[model samples]
Target: MGRKQSFTATELLDTTKRLVLEHGYDGFHLKLLSEHLPGARSTIYQYYSNKEEIVAACMKHVIVTVLEQASAVDETDAMSALQQLLLIYVGESQLHQLLGDAYKINTANSPAAANDLEFVEQAHLTLKSQLTRLFERAQQDKKLRNDIPLPVLVGVFFNLINTPNMLNIPTPQWSELLFQMWIGGARS
Candidate 1:
């Protein structure tokens, strides 16, 4: 009989990210993940075929989690929706790191790498579509500037999450100032 399941897919993915950060994708393996997680190597194999499959799964998890959180915001308030999504990105620094890793590894000429890129690209499209919809709504209500194209406005909204943190400013103050600057500039 198979061993009882001891870890969840989320737990496995979380461990995978940590291990990837520590050892990098080339150096990671299911054995390492198994040791860090509460399961045997076979248990990990039950869910994934190999390192690439697991990595792809992990990236997909990040994409889905972010999209779900972003989608939960009230659509009636475009600014609030954008701000909430940005706030989530600000809070989850690790998500960007994982995405960076995915981008770095995606150039490899392998099916797994292609799959990884597919997940990242899908995430990008999903975010763009969601933000574009919100921006359109805001524009129809005359809450946003009419001069900028809808795609550009959507790009600006998503760009808010990439605000640099080199100065080590606290997030609350950082987000507040960022939002103020965005609203001040983008408002009609």
Candidate 2:
């Protein structure tokens, strides 16, 4: 047998994310990944049962970073935390867009879908709760408008943050504008 290829799970996920973004979920294949990396297809299969599992794993990798940034926020400073989280959301917009594209394509329906869906639901709930609490605090402090319900407000912010590609605006400018338009009132 040939010597085993040495690689870390992080390296695999990083390469997977890059490949998925370049090829999209439908165009992405395990063979392509194996060809792109220095490992054998069997090595990849050892870590992930299929391409779908790797895609899900890559998303989870990104979600972990989002949560870590949110966790680093000080409890007393909700607005600041919220801003940081929004920036994080913008930073990951390409990954989010890739996931969106993946969902649209009818490809690679692996058994891992159920687990991935569950994990995504939980992560979304966690992120939503954190956002809702911050908006609630901001509302209480008269920093945000109370006319919009918290859930709707959170949804709007989430939708907006994921729209880096749609907006046609520069990232830094778009982020600042997003914060100002969503969190800070237009008049402010």
Task: Judging by lDDT against the true structure, name the best candidate.
Answer: 2
lDDT of each: 0.75, 0.76
In candidate 1, stretches whose alpha carbon ends up further than 4 angstroms from where it belongs are 1-6, 22-24, 38-40, 93-97, 100-123, 149-152, 164-174, 185-188
Clash count for each candidate, listed in order shown: 0, 0
Per-residue C-alpha lDDT of model 2 across residues 67-113, encoded as one tens digit per residue: 78777777587677777777778877774655565454333466575
C-alpha positional error of residue 124 in candidate 1 after TM-score superposition, expressed in Å:
3.7
TM-score of each: 0.70, 0.76
Clashing pairs for model 2 are: none
lDDT of each residue in 81-148, candidate 1, tens digit only: 76776677666656766766674554454576577669778886887788778778888889888898
